[model samples]
Target: MDMSSISRHEFRLEFLVTSLLFTAFCGYGLVWIEELVISEHWPLDEQRFWPGKSYDLNGYLDIIVAGKEHPQYGRPNILSLRYLDEVARINQYIVHNITVPVDLEGKHYEVAYTDLCMSFDWACYLNDHLTMLMPKSRWGNFSGPIAEFASDIINNEVNITYPIGWRGSEPIYFGALVGRPHLVDREGHFDHATALRLTYNVGNISYIWRKKLASWLTNKEKPPSGESQMLSETAAGEGQAHCCLV
Candidate 1:
């Protein structure tokens, strides 16, 4: 064959190979993106944990519980709610039953209201932000199967029969207070107010909390008072602190 013809034939072969490689890369990229989106929006069948059925909380001592880990490293299929009445009742019971420590006397000790309020605000902000991305109805409501599924879960999990006494909204207060010590450190004094103030400008608090929960579960072991239990709680708490500060 002549030089011109041989060069043309080689060019065509090169173009064909390059085109196949480019197409394969694009296809793989699309599939990866789709998998990531699906994992975030939908829970895997194997990781769908129901409280009474798949897992039992009776083994744990703490009132707040963490769900099973997500298979895809995405969002876990768990709903978190702070029951106002139930929390109040528990606080009241603790105040009446437990004696105050001598060192904490005369201090204006209070619940971690700043953290609580911030958490609530973050949740509201996230909801509003995500809702804007979703399709809505004429009545300013989210519409679709995902919305319906979320509504059903919330309704089933939350006890709406509780009485409501307050109507007006209150201003969010942010300040330091003598509050409960760190869960993992009984002797060490680390209040929520200080923690919140330190981590205020850091990353999302929700993600930090989730990381903490995951650490807690992974490090948890039999016999709550065991070394492993303490290590787990410490790891989780440390993760929250580090992530928040970072």
Candidate 2:
């Protein structure tokens, strides 16, 4: 073989060995690196939390075991006018585009002005941000269902009864138990000011819930099972929602 060819062959062999050794060194380094752990004092004082950041949900585990008195994520209630504007202006199209998973316990209740107002608000907010990828909005174009549900609510065809007074006449509701998945943006980037705001954990839970609900709407699947307990006095308030996110 020519001297140049011989040199090229030798260089190729050396490069392969060096590459293999580098990868092996990296693998060893990873095993020895210390892992990150949350501070033990996290739950005692929520000051350790990051605003609009989704931390481990283990902090709120007590609610799962709290039993009846503990409360669901928040009480269901009327959708505010501000929220309605969000739907028309922002998240409406977005929510209709994706799917979300929620252990929806109660029947898909009819809409009162309160219900439409709240969910429409969320839909609008969802549409504004949450690109078609990642945390993409998933509320489907169920105007028909919504309209029908609204009519039903108007006519009192279905029971407007949610034993939980917190959940008065709102069309949409959601929560997380102890260690399930959550669906929140936690960035405080979304327009929850108009819609009902939630804490970090609550927002995290809502993010997942909304996503899943969006997916279900996209697929036209029936709502999932498992019931959600309640929490807090006011319900998905903006500041409160951001808090739970962390």
Candidate 3:
């Protein structure tokens, strides 16, 4: 073979292999890191963590509700709970601002009393999902980030919650759960992408790890501000679609 032809073929082969590895790397990152923060289980663990940062959370929360932030709605203040009884205090702080009648109609709901303090990532998820799910409601389809988290936690296969359809299909249908106080929505998935955020939990943010974990994380939320169903479940009946299409 001519040198030019051989070089061209080698470069193509190299590019293809590199792309594959890059893709895998991204996927790993997404599963291990991004999903945890934005998907199903991070907040659950956080809820538990917040209560136990000191001697406070010992009996109140032995299993879940760690690190959960009871941030005041509308206002930037966070009540910061250490016990379940604090729910009353938390309610007084930011509960009123939460959608009172609990409707997801044309009106723009407040940023959510608890949601007011969404990390940058959480904020992006809300905007993207709200625009994606609610607009689709016009076409008889609905989905969003909160919906994604709820599904991840309660989907039948995972069985985080009892009874197949206990949590409804999408987050909007169950927005009240966020305000319910006793709801236990939690799951632990540390495959690769979820492991990305998990890596932070475990402490590893190198480029290589981030690259592999990125793919898993990307599934956590869409790029934000698009009108696609994101997943392929039929509207209304499918409830919440769980996991990735891949």
Task: Judging by lDDT against the true structure, name the best candidate.
Answer: 1
C-alpha local distance difference test of each model: 0.31, 0.30, 0.28
Candidate 1 per-residue lDDT, tens place, 31-137, comes to 98887776565433222422112221111112221223346753222211222222233323322332222224666533321222222224311112112112223
Candidate 2 per-residue lDDT over residues 81-165, each given as its tens digit? 3323332322333223333433347645332211211222133122221121112123233466586665554445322112111
The runs of at least 3 residues in candidate 3 whose Cα sits more than 4 Å from the true structure, single-residue gaps closed, are: 39-42, 45-246
Each prediction's TM-score against the native?
Answer: 0.22, 0.21, 0.20
Inter-residue clash pairs, candidate 1: none
Worst 10 residues of 1 by lDDT: 159-168
Is candidate 1 or 3 superior in TM-score?
A: 1
Per candidate, the number of residue pairs that clash is: 0, 57, 48
Better of 1 and 3 by lDDT: 1
